[model samples]
Each structure stands twice: as C-alpha cells, then as structure tokens.
Target: MPLWLLLMLWRGSVAQVLSYKLKLQKSMTVQEGLCVHVPCEFSYPWLSFISAYVSWFQKGADVNQDPPVATNKPNQKLHERTQGRFFIRGDPQTGNCSLDITEVHMGDSGTYFFHLGTYSYLDTMFSLNVTALTHTPHIIIPGTLESGHPRNLTCSVPWACERSTPPIFSWTSAALTSLGPRTHLSSVLTLTPRPQDHGTNLTCQVYFPAAGVMVERTVQLNVTYAPQNTAIRIFQGSRTALGTLQNTSSVFILEGQALQLLCVTDSNPPAELSWFRGSPTWKATPICRSPILDVSQAGAVEEGDLICQAQNLLGSQHISLHLSVVYPLQLLSPSCSWEGEGLRCNCSSRAQRAPTLRWRLGEELLEGNHSNASWTVTSSLVGPWANSSLSLSGPLGSGLRLSCEAQNAQGKQSAAVLLLPDKPEPRTSGVIEAVAGAGTMALLSLCLCLIFRVKTGRKKTVQPVQSMDMSPAGSSGSGAYQHQSWTDIPAAPPAPAEARPISEEEQELHYALLRFPKPKYQEQEDIHTEYSEIKTHK
Candidate 1:
C-alpha cells in the first residue's frame, strides 16, 4: 500500500470511467422482423476482462414499479417479452459485451442497463434505451382517385406501448396533413388528385426518436378518369380543315375515294370509340365500332354526316363531320346555231356540284354589249347536266364567236363555237342583185308604153266633141249660135266690127281627166243627175 500503488489504482478507475459509454443511444428504433446490433465497449483490466460476467437489463415507462422485461445474462431465464429475440455473441477473451437481437418485436422500447461483474459488480451510470419500431408506416388510399375530386390518404404506425413515444411521420407529397397520436400514430394527407397522378407513388415515412433510419412505405395510385377533350379529325384528304370536318367547309370526296374519320381522345384506360352516320342525338344511328370511322364508298349516293363518338366506363362524347362528293364542271356538246336573224347558242354541262356558267361573245362577258344583242341567259338543269343558251342578233355579214364557261368549286372548263349562217359569197351576191334590178326595170317600161297608146286614142275622140258641140249650158247670146245646147240672140245697133284670128302660141293640149274623183260641182250634179250617172261608167 504505497502511494504509487494507490495512484495507479486511482488512474485505472479514471480510465474506466472515461472510456466506457454508460448510455446506449438515448433511444434506438429498429424495425420488426429485422436484426439489430447493440454494441457495448468499456475500459477494463486486460487480464480480468470477462465477457461471461456481463449482464443487461431493461426498464419501461414505470421504471420505479414495473418489473424489468428483457435481459441478456444466463443465470436467469430470458423475459417472456424478449425471450427468443435477444442474444450476446462477444468473445470471452474480449471486453466487448455487444448484444445481438433477431427479429426485433414491439414492446422492446425502454431503457436498458449494462453491468460488468468483477470482485465488486458495477452497472453503467446512465441507462441505455432500446426501441423497436412498433409498426412500419403504411399508406391507405381510396378505391379510385379521380381528377378534380378531393381525396385523403392516411399513413399509420402503431406504437409498441401506450406510453411509447410518438413516431415522427413525414409525407412525400407537399399536401396539407394532420398528425394524430394514440395507440397508433397517423398522418392524414388531404389533396386533389389529377390524371397525372396515375402510376405515381404516395410515400410516407415514420421516424422514431433515436432511430437513424426512417420506415418508408408507398402506395401507387391507380387513378380512374373519364376521357379527355374529345375531338374529330381527318388524317386523309388535302381539303380537310382545322383537322376536323367543318360544317362551314364542305369535305369533298372524289369518285371512288375513301373517307376516314378519327375520334381523338386521352384517357387513363383506352377509350372505346364508335361512329354514327348523321348528327348524333339521343336516338342517333350508330354505324360502326372503332376510333377510325370508315366510309367505304363515300359520296357514292348522297352526302351525309360522320359522327365520331368516344366513350368509356365513365362517359361518352361526339363530333360531327359533313361528307360530300365534289367534281369540276364537265362541258357537254356546246354549239351555236342560227335561229332566224339571231345566232342561238346551246350548251349543256355535266357536274355533280352546282356551277356558275356565263356566256361570252368575243370579249363581252357581262351581258349584251350592243343594242342588237341580248343578255346572256342561263337555264336550269334538265337532266344530269345544266343547259344554257344565248341569242345574239345583229346586222352582220360575218360569223360571230361565242363561248360558254362552266365554273364550280373544283375548276372551270369553257366550250366555244363560231356562229355562222349559210349565205352567198360577197362576189356572187353582187351578180344576183344586178340581175334582179334589170328584170324590175323591164316590167316598168312595158307598163309605160301601154298607157301612152291609150292616151292617143282618147285625144282623137275628144277633138270631135270640141269641133261639133262647143256650147255652154246657159248662154245669153252669140254672133252665131251654131250647134249650141241652149242659146240667146243679142240686137246690134248700126255697128260694123272686124274679129282678129287666134295664134298658135295660145293653143294648149287637153289634159286627161279622172272619172272617180269628180269636179267641185259634183255634189250639185248629184242632185240633178241620176244615181246611175253618178256611178263610174266602167
């Protein structure tokens, strides 16, 4: 018992106190069905270090009254709570008294003590705690998570004991949540799920007080939703508009062309699509069953509507497309013929669609350009083709040119013809005109000769009447009343007179008289004369 020996003993005790970790992790969190390693190391005299002399103990919430539940020593049997779960495998020569636990179960969360038995037994100053994860966090979700609908998910972790500390819960989603602590701890997350949430995992983690790792669990949501915005589209045809068959735009199909329509939609599960023939109503006629609506022979008969319908277990939607056949104007026999003085033009064109046809004479396209011609006229369809006619009349010596143009949505084709009439040539026409003139002059000259001969005969008869009876109807007197119808004699008183002879210059030829137009005294003569005398003496 020297001073040096006393100092060495004091230093050894100090080393033991400085090197031993009296407290295991204040609390440890381990998962169920998993193994945990609790290591204990302390400074001890090299030769006296004994693994067989070590012992471990556990204390629950009521440490002062509750009996210990677990231990690793061999002198006493294992506690029922941790009987088959606890083991210590440190070598006998080593000072290590590390404990190995298998399939850690709940009810293991409590304070633990480590003791080393020597000449005098000593237990660690501070008690270590071993916590076994009561329950791994799990997620509970609803049957269906639809877009725009409110939803909630609960993450729960059971506590080992009523007095067990609350396990920290965390949610992967940044949603509003509420934490509840009871026999079990729960974190409820509230959110609205969208279609994008399909196949996404909602995760929850449970962390114990002293556990280095958190227990994580996930639930993959299988979101059930209706079909997205349904639209109609036409993948074929260069004439398609807005990727749809628009009522404003007539979808034209050529002869023998196929019309295909698609019902475009987006959904969780693929949507079932159908086709209808007309404007789809409550009582619409369904044509086929597919996203691709096929019109095998489009425009074979008449135009119709193609309604595309998309549906699922959720709902159905539709769109309509107008189908029509289109063709350019086809001109039939277009010709110009003579109709009396005017040249009549007739033309008929074949087309399935309506076409605007106009008539043009040379450069005149609007209507009539001259006073002699009439406006261009259009006629309704007589049969498969539209008939049009135009009458062009004018004083002309040459043929006129006319055209008929048929215009439609597809294109335009015009038919033209020259309007000519059968006529004599200009050179031959002059000869025929001269011959007609000569014949007319000869007939007039013959009539003039006949009139002259009749006048000569009439003058001879009038001369005899003038020489025989040149008497007045009422005469007072005359030098000699010879051959007078009525005459009177005048008395001469002792007077001798000589009369002069008439000169030839004073003579005049008698003019012919008309019997029908009588003189001015004809009205007076009618009273004195008989009806037979007033009549012509033909």
Candidate 2:
C-alpha cells in the first residue's frame, strides 16, 4: 500500500467519525401539561447499526455527566432519574432521532443530548432543548344575548408558533352537560341564544397535550332581554280607591257629580291608555262585558284615571288616563245680593242640563211683565278665557236688583247690583255751577269790549278832522276815547300809568324783549268766548 492512499483512508475514517450530528429542528416552547415534540436528526452511517441503541441524556451535575433517557438498553443510573416522563420514537436507519413528550410537566424542560453506542464505543453526542409548553387558551365574553339573536365568543392562544399544534376547544355550562365540537383558530363561536338559557354560566376550555389536565382555560357568559308580568294600581288624591257596584244611591246624582280614580303599574313594556273605570270583577255587569263603557249623566262621576297595560313575552307595562264627568248647569234659590255695586245670586234647577237664565217675579218670567227692569246672563266653558255676557237695563229708581248669572253645562255663577237712587255730590255739582257762572261773565266782558272797539273807531274817524285844526277840543276827545278804550281792554289795568301807544314795529321789539307768559285756562276761555261772539256776529 502506498503511504498517501493509507493517509487518505485514515482521513476519510476521521471525517465520517466527526460528521455525525444531531440537534433540535428549531427552538420550541410549550406550556405545562401540554404535549411537545422535540425535533431531532442525525448524520452518521452507524445510525442504521445502533438505531435501537440510540439514547437521550440530559445535562447532569458535571459537564461530563450526561444522564441517559428512554432507550433500548437503559442504564439503571439514568432510568431512575427520568423514567416515564419522556418517550422516543425514531428510525436510526434514516438518521431521525426525534422525541415526543406527553403530559409534559414544568420539570421536563431542559437541554437534551442524543448518543449512540456502536462497535463497543460511544459516538460524539448531539444536543437538543426540551421546553415545556406553558401557555393556556384565552376566553372572551360579549355583553348581552337575546333570544333568537346571534352571539359571538372567542378563544385564542396568547403565543403561537408554526411548529406548535393548534389548540382544541370544548364548551361546558350548567345547561349543557357535555363538551361540544372543537373550534378552529381565529374562529368565532356563533349561536342564537334563548331566554331560558340566560344567566347560565358558559365556559370555553382549551386543550393542549403538553400542558396537562390542570392548566385548561375558561370564561363565563352573561345575557339580557325584555320584561314581563305587568299589573295595574289605582289611587285617589293620595289615597287608593276601590271599585264599587252601587247604583242610583247618593253616589249617583241627576245633575252629575262623580269621583275619579287613578291606576299605575311597572313593567319592561311601556304602558298605554287613559283612566278607565268599570266592575272588572262582575262578568254580568254591562260595563264589564262591553268593550266600551257609557258614561252616566244622572249620577255625575268625578275626574279619574284609567291605566292600560303594554306587555311582551318577557314582562308587562302600564300607563294611565284621566276621566272627568260632565254635570248639568243649575241656579239655586234665585236670590240676589250686591257685589261691588253689582247684584249676584244663585238659582235652583232640577233639569238634567244646566238651566237657561229666565228672571221670574212671583213665578212668571220677567220678560213679559217687567218692561222696566234689565237682566244679563254670562256663561263660561270649563277652560279659561271661554266666556259670554248678556246685559239688560230698566228704570233707575225701579227698586229692583240687577243680576248677572254665569252658567256652564255643569253649573252656574251669578252676581247682582241694587237699583237704588243715588243723590249727586254737592261739591261736584258746585264745580259745574262755578264753570257756568265764569263762562257767563266772560261772555259779558267780550260783548263790552266789542262795543268799546266800535265806539273807538267812530271817535277816531270824527277826531281826524279835528286833529287838522291841532285844537284842544280834538285833543280832549282823543284822550277821553283812549281812556275809555283802555278801560274796555281789561288787561293789566293799563300797567299803573298810561303807556304810549306802540307802533307795530315797536310792539314787535317789545315782544322780543319780553318772555312769553304760559297760557292760563281763564285767559284761554276769554279768548275762545270772544272769537265765538265775533263768529256769531258775522
């Protein structure tokens, strides 16, 4: 043999010996109580020879002390430590050394080593990591579940891996005794819930083989729906009232006076309807049997409420109505008394409808016999601002009371005033007399001033010829006329001394210098009288 060929053969042997290797396919993590598969593969021709001899070992107290796990020939030293917790299934012929661990516990997590014994020698070791699966499924619940309504719930994994097996699902509730079908990942559990199943505790449990029985996931369920079982209640003012079966008795009146009752109740369904009254207990009663009840006029019923119920399959509801009875209008005693100088009174009536107003003196209607007396009637409707008034008047000294009566379909209201003679006040009459006397005096003064103006004009015409002579006779005549004219003017008594007759221009300047005096009634009256007289003369 050549030396180089021998070296080549030796190198090939070394390479084959050094090349055999095993490791986990990829990193993996698993929850406790779940199943995990630790992937493993090897490279070695001896794998086929000692396929059954392949053993798994975990790192021990020392670097050299690798403890053996399930294998064809287990060492007592290794078997005592890791028995029953791990199992291996693989084909050494194909160089596959993978492991499948079931019911994995927290203690099963650690580094693993695969070793093969062949030809009386242990080969180089292959390393792997065995991690316990440690996650559980999560459950979520939505707020409400109505009967015949679709519901959605979810279960999911907190952490997932491509190699990790998808979780399986099972549902349990007080209403359901057994688990249902398994659900898929990212899938919704949809169901139409019913009322009967409301308030039941629903649970979703997740299964992972590696994380054993004690670590399942679960969640609770809640549901809501409409109401049921409605009823009615009644009250009057503050006190509750009971239905009665009495007929025309004092409780019943010809005019109409009645009591009202109110009804109320609670339910999920809203209540509808107004106040209603009848003998619900007595089947034979007309009102009880009839769909509608006729209100009685003779026996006036008072205001009351009728309550009606609204209901669903789940619960009942209630509402109310107010009822008022109409009464006939009537006057009682027909007597009159004064109110603010007006007469008021009530008249008696037995008629079913309010009586129309007709004044009667000793049983005869006043319209025919009383030609002097006046009468008025006023009526109003139940609501505000609905009113009508009628009035009649007669001789002032007739010694009769004037009456005002208000009537409605239900009742009457009236007022009156006495027709007594009223004497006029002396002071008020005296003021009128003084005004007349002053007016007469003013007329006389106005007539005198008109006569004086005519006399002054005549004197001026006669004196103009005499003034051409510049004679004493002319001057004396002018002075006398001026004095008489000033006396007739009756203004400020000529200002104590005679004032020179001012020209029109001078008068204007004087007016400009003087403040205008405020007008007085007496001055205005005199002016008005003078103007009237001048108009009469024209």
Candidate 3:
C-alpha cells in the first residue's frame, strides 16, 4: 500500500514542476539613470474563468514577507525601492509578462523573477547589470555658425527614460547665449556667435538628481566672421614701429627717407591684405599683394595717397594714408647790378615748403619789404619758390660780403658775393689842394689894405691916394687897376705853408668803385651809378 501511494506523489510533484513553464531574455545590461525592457511569456495550468494577476520580485527576496517590485493585482503593494520605477507592462490574460524598469540604479543590479498568482518561475529569469552612467549628452548644431547671427542649439539625453525625474540642464560658453525651450530630457540654447567666440568650447551638462550622476559634452565652435578692427602700422625702419593708424591720416616724410607699412585685421578666417596706390576700388589691381608695403626713397617724389585693404569672405575693410614728401630749402646764385647811386641784388630760391628769403649784409640779417636810410629789402613767396630784392644806397665799405639766404623747416641755404678794393683817383685829389692855396692869398690881401688906411688917416693928407682896396671896380674900366692893387697887397708878410711834405706811403689813398653789370635779359636802361670808397693813410 505505501509503495503505490509514494510513486503517485513523486510523479505528481514532477508533473507540477514541469507545468510552470516560462520564456524570457536571460540577461540585460542597462546604464544607471536609464531604462530597460525584458520581454517574457509563460504558460501555466489555470482555470479560464478566474482572473489572474502577474507580479515581479527581486531575487533572494521572500514573496510572502517582502513586497513584490511590480504587480498587476488591484490591491497589491509594491517594494519601496522600485515602487514607481518598476512595472509589469503586458496583460496576464494574454499570457504576457514583460518587465519594464526606469531610472535603474546601481542598487537594482541583481536577478529578478516573475510570479503568476500563487505560482513562481525561478528558472526563467533575467539578470540586470546596472553599470555606472557612461553616456554623454548629445550636442546638436543645426548649421554653420556665423558671427552676429543667432541660432538654436539642442542638448539632449535621448537614451534616458522619460518616466525618470527630469534632469537639470546647464550650458557653459564664452559666447553670447540665453535660455530657450526645455523638454523631458533635453534643453535648447540660443547662441549668438562672435569673432572672438571662434574655436571656443561650449559645454552641455545634464545632472540626474535621482541617480546623483552628471554627464556632459563639450564642442568647439567654428564661427565665420568678416574682417574687423582694420588698422595700419607705420614702421620707421625694419625694427622700430612708430605708431598705429586706424583711420585715414595725413603724414609727412623727409625727401630721402624710407617707410614701411603693415596692415592688420581680425577675422575668423584669415583675411587678405593688399596695398593700393591711391583711392582705388576693390576691383583695381593692388600695388602690393602682401600685408607689408615698402616705400623706397626713389618713390617719395610721387607722394599723394596710399591705401591698405583687408578683405575676407564675409566682408572687407580699409584705411588710407596720405603722403607728403618734403624737401630742403634751396637758393640760386644772386644777381647784382648798379642803379643810380644804389646797388640792386636779386635772389631766387625754391623748396617743398614755402621758404623765407632774407638779405645778409656784413653780419646783419635783413628781412621783409622794409626800407631804412641806407638799404631797402623787398621779398615775395609763391608756393615753394621765394624771391627777394635788396637795394643799398649810401657810403659803401670796401671788402664787404653780401649774401642772400633762404630757410625752411627742412634746411637753409645761402649765396654770397664778395666786394674787392679799387685804386684811388690821384687827379681828382690835386685840384682840391690848389683851390685851397688861392683862398689863403685873398684873405691876406684884405688884412694889408686895412693897415694902410689907418696910416693915411694919421698923416691928415687930403689928397686921396689911389684906393689900394681890391674891390669890385665900378662901371669904369678898372681891370688893370684891380690887378695892380692885388700885387701891391703882397708886400704884406708872405703866408707860411700849412701843407706837410708827402711821403711815398702817404702819396696814394685806396678807393673802391663797385660797378655791377646788368643782365642781358633786363629791358631797363643801363645804370651808370658807381660807389667810391676813399680813405687816407694814418
């Protein structure tokens, strides 16, 4: 009796173990803060009219004491650890048992089993490996970034579950940016790119509060921009930088100097720099294709305007440099001629800048069109040329130098003429001495006549002696009487000679006669004026 009963029980237990059959995915891998779905189906012996419920529980947990992680029953309670994150999605009436887990954490890593009513299947289960979050946020750049243009950028965590707590999104960038729309797992950012923002890093960070994990992605921005901050640098030589010019400017340079100019600008893509001769347009061919422009001394004569241009694919910019070449003052040889009792001199000069003309007469600086007692100076300036006329009318000094000088900011120049001594006139001096001796004889005759008149008065002689006074004779012919009276007056004392004996050294005095030859181009009559300087030896 015992053998038959035990054989029946053993067969029944084996049949019950084989009847609870299930099919499901064996193992699944899910990152923390993400979701996973385990597809499962099971066939169990049950009545058709009775309603059945499906449930899921963590491995090594008591189904009766510890609550199930998921349940489809109306009044069944769930595990606090996975109450909202774990659920059984399929209907039990259709023999479908799919386990869905959202916001899976590291603590949820283990084996799980499915239960249908009072029956449980442990052989057909799935293992969830909840690894550390390794997924990064995705940065979506719709198109090319252009400077000064605003565009929307999207940062999303598409792999994260929507049922999980919304993640906090943040953006970090050096560009001008503002907040845009936000969804369950993504955030939008409105970005305005600038030239300076090129090649800069933009980071998108997502923080999952439930999992206490954060993920981020960084991308470098490529911004297209136009040429900006166009400027020209002036270099005096190869090594020295004089200054920087950002706008149009006028500059002056010495005649024999060289200049070096460099153009610079800011842009995303490299800009092309060029140098133009004058006010040329963009279509004109440039004098220099590089950024550096070298101006040699030979080209200084053609000074006017120079332009520097910086162009890029986006836009272009330029600056102008006005040039003025200055030269030193120059003076031509002075021309001199003799006018009526005066010496006339004309001087002409030219220079880049208007030069001042003046006359230099023996250490005296004479300027302007003013007149004095001895000399008159008249000057005129037109453009770069200057002309001056000097007239001297007075006692002339021998061995004197007269010079014409011109001066300006660049330099000064002068031209001079030397006056030479001339021989004295001996004939003109001898007649002056003879006239002095005749005047002395006349004075002595008058004194002798006065003395004779006094003696005649003392004698009381009534007879009038021939009047010895040599005076102008009346209407009568008394030419011979006047001669006799003059001879008789000489009986008075002979006048002593006041003249000194002349020595060889004192015989001749030096005189200078300055005579200027008139130019053939002049139409005025030739002047005969001459200046003579005479001096006696001491």
Candidate 4:
C-alpha cells in the first residue's frame, strides 16, 4: 500500500462524488388549502461517509430571492420548527428528496428549490403553480327543457388556465358522466325531460385540488307541457259523457242535420287547440279553429269519430268523440192484412239511435200471442234500422183505430190505421143495441130482396135453393151454419145465406118499417152460394 496509490483512489472517489446528479421536477400544480408533492431523486457515490439531510426553499416572485420552507434533519420533527402544513415525505438516506405541501394557499405559489446537505449542501429550484378556486361549483341549464324531449345540463368548474389540472366532479344523480377535456372542467348530465319532472332539484358536487374542499351547487329544472284533459258539448244535443270528462265519448242528436260542437280543455301554459278528423294527418290540416266545430257543412259526412288536440311547446294531447247524426223516428205507414181469424199490422222505419216501438188500439196497448207485436234492430250496409209489427184478432171491435209509435233518444214518430170503413156513432142505452141490430137486419133483407128479384125472371120454376121458415114479424134467422166473428154485431153471427122460391109479387110488399126476420132452423145448406158479400145501405 503505497501512499501514491491511496492518493489516486481518494481523488477518484472525490471525482465520483462531485459527478453525482440531483433530479428535480420542473414544476408542480397546487390548489388553495390542498396538498401537493414535489418530485425529487438523486444519485451519489455509494458507501460514502457523509450523512445527508433534505430541505425545501420557496422562491419569491422576484428573480433573486429564496427562503427555506421545510427540512428533514435527523432527530427533528416537522411540527417543532415548521407548521403542520409542510413536511418531508422522502428520505435522503435512500436518495428520495420529495417534499409535501399541505393546506396550500395562494401565497404559496412561487418557485421552489430542494437541497441535499451534509457538511455543505447541493440545491436546485423548480416552479410551483398554485390556483385558488375557493368558491362553490356552478351548474348551468341552457334555455328551457321541454317535456318528453332529450336534453343536457352542465356542472362547470372554473380553472386558472387551459393547462391547469382539471378538478374531479361528482353528481348527486348517477346520470353524470365525463367528456374528455374542455376550456372549463365539467361533467355533463343527460336526461329525457318529462312533465312530472318539472321543478326537480339537481345537485353537482366538485372536489378541487386547491384546498381539497368539496363544493355543491343545485339548480331547478323547468319543464313545459300541454293539456292533459279535454271535453266537448253540442248545441241542441245532450252533453257528451254527461260531464266535463277528457273523453267526449258520444253525442246524440236529431231533427236537423247541422250541428255545433264546442271543445273545452285544461292545460298548463295555455295550449293551442284545434279540431280534426280521426287521424293524425288531420292535425296538419285542421278542419276548423277555436273550441267550436261545425259538423254539418253541406255535403260533408259527419257520422264518424272526430279528434280534438291541445298542444304546446312541450307536447300534445288528444280527445276523441263520436258524432252520431240521427233523425227523428220515422214510422212508415202501417198496413193491416187479414190472416185467418186475426189481422196483422206491420210498421217499419229508420232511426238514428236505438228505438222502441209500441202498438196501441186507440187508448189501450194491444198485443196478440203468435200474431202478436214484434220489434227488432237491423243493420244494413249503410247503418242500423228497426222494424216492428202488431196483430189483432177478428174479435176486435169495428171502428177501432190502431196507432204505432216509434220513439228514440232523438224524437218520436207515429202512424195510425183504421179498422172500420167509417167513423162509428156512439150508443147510449141497451135498447139502442136491439134497435141498431134490427136496422142492420132489415137493410140486409132489402139487399137480399133486390138480388132475388133480379133472379126471378132468369128462372121460371123456383129452384128451391132451400126453404126458409116463412115466419112473419121478428123472431130469429137461422141457416145450415151461422157466420162467426162478424164485425157488425158484438155476439150474434150473421145468418147463413139461403135460396128459395120467390114469386115476383112478394117483392112489391111495402110496410111502415120492416122488422128483422126471426132465426129459423134449416135442415141443410142452401142450394145457392156458400159465402156471399154483404152490401150495406149507406
């Protein structure tokens, strides 16, 4: 071991120590009252005997000023010499010289330097940029949000520069998300606005680096929408659906074909309303304006459903109504036809709505069993119609007037039929019944006499059709069979016709007033007609 060899090694070691490099971060970013880390690393000769200490110095705004801020010396706690805000996070023994700055303030914005010291010290400086955003976060909602439409809201945080670190943002609603980087640090909130969401509160929370303090801001959402209910009324017709319901439902009318319909609505922000046909295309070209709509315009078909729409900037609502244009019950003339022992009367007509039909004999409602009354609702290619019928037996009295009334919600109509040839005269006493019967019998006897007189010359011998009781005065008239259910008499049937020998002289017999011939027994049918038409004296 020569002294010269040791001196050479010593000089080499000194040169290696002098060549060691201290790496320092060029700049750091900080927010008011927040914490920041200064990056530092260094390389020195290994196994060296010099112990090293780490220190930090904050430079002034001026070019030539520097002041010590914090240090890590052996056996020294950070709180003994400096405030709790500043500390050393790295160990010089491990060549880590990183510094920590907590509770940073605006005045802490300056150039900073780091030093590694043993017997002497080696120092280098870096830039510190501090931004103060001590206020609350701001929320922005542009314009008005329309219900049922997609829209966006913004949570914005102001920064000192475009290059400044962006603040972390959180929203009370999970719908918040991030969009890359912009001039302002922001989080976007996307939503589809709804009418029920009006006046809802939305909050945006932001965590800033300056002081590590979180700020919250809230903004209310404004949503616009149209009417939710509508109703209609018709003049000269019943109110639709009974009251002011959203559905106009149905309206019935009679008489005139023309109609007036009024529409009423409830809405927010005052809706723009109009009348239309059944489809959405009708809205583009409305049939009319305002609340009133005229359905009967000349040849227009107003029988189908119509729509009323109320609209605003937000949305539109519609109400549906059926316009049933109906006319009064139209009863056609009823005709009576004889069917066996009974008579049938058939009445029919057209009506707008459902109709009820009834038959009345003067004041009493009349109905027959099988030959009875009937009513029906029938549908055609055009629309619906009703038909009805009534029947009566031969026992029905003569001069009975039958009336058929057809009625509906619109109105009523009627038709009548007369069962007799002429208007009947009333009878007062029971004796009048016998007198009237006698008069009828005498009139019929006169007709028979005229018929026999005409035939007397045709036949010389009496081809005795049958012999009648040459009885006199007034007793009774009987034949092989009596006609039953005749209208002239209430109970007695017409006498069966007979033919007998008649001398021409008997036709000339004249009396004050001829009495009714008495009914007499007959052995068999007459040789002449079985049935004969009766002729009455007017």
lDDT of each: 0.55, 0.43, 0.76, 0.59
TM-score of 2: 0.37
For residues 1-538, write the lDDT of model 3, one tens digit per residue: 7999999999998887776889898999999988898898888775355567778988988988889999988777888889888888887787889988888889999999988767779877889998999999999999889998999999999989888899999999999999999999899999999999999999999999988889999999999999888998888866599889898897777778888888999986889999898877747999999999888782445588889888888988888998777766767777766787777888888877778999888989999989999999999887668999999987576766688788888778777765544322111112332453355455543332231223322333222233333323342342222322222211223222332333545332222222333322322244332222211112
State each model's C-alpha RMSD to the native. Answer: 25.5, 22.6, 17.6, 16.2
Model 4, position 351: C-alpha lDDT score: 71
* lDDT by residue (tens digit), candidate 1, 190-240: 767777776777788876553244678877777777777777777556535
Error of 3 at 35 (Å): 1.4
lDDT tens digits, residues 1-538, model 4? 9999999999998897685777887888776655677778776665255667666655532212333567666554333223555677887777887877765667777776665543122355677787865567677777777766666677776542233345677666423233433334687777676666666777788765644556778777666767776677665344344344466577655445556677776555778878887765632787776888875541227777788888776567888887676755666666556566666666666777746666776777643222323322222223545666665554666666667677777678776664444323222123333465477667655643653322322433322222233332232445433322222322223333444334555433221222344444565433443233332111
The model with the greater TM-score, 1 or 2, is: 1
Clashes of each: 0, 51, 0, 13
Number of the top-ranking candidate, with lDDT as the measure = 3
Candidate 4, residue 285: how far the Cα is off, in Å: 29
TM-score of each: 0.49, 0.37, 0.68, 0.41
Better of 2 and 3 by lDDT: 3
Superposition error at 338 for model 3 (Å): 5.4
Write down the TM-score for model 4.
Answer: 0.41
Candidate 3, residue 49: the lDDT equals 53
Candidate 3 at 186: error in angstroms? Answer: 2.9
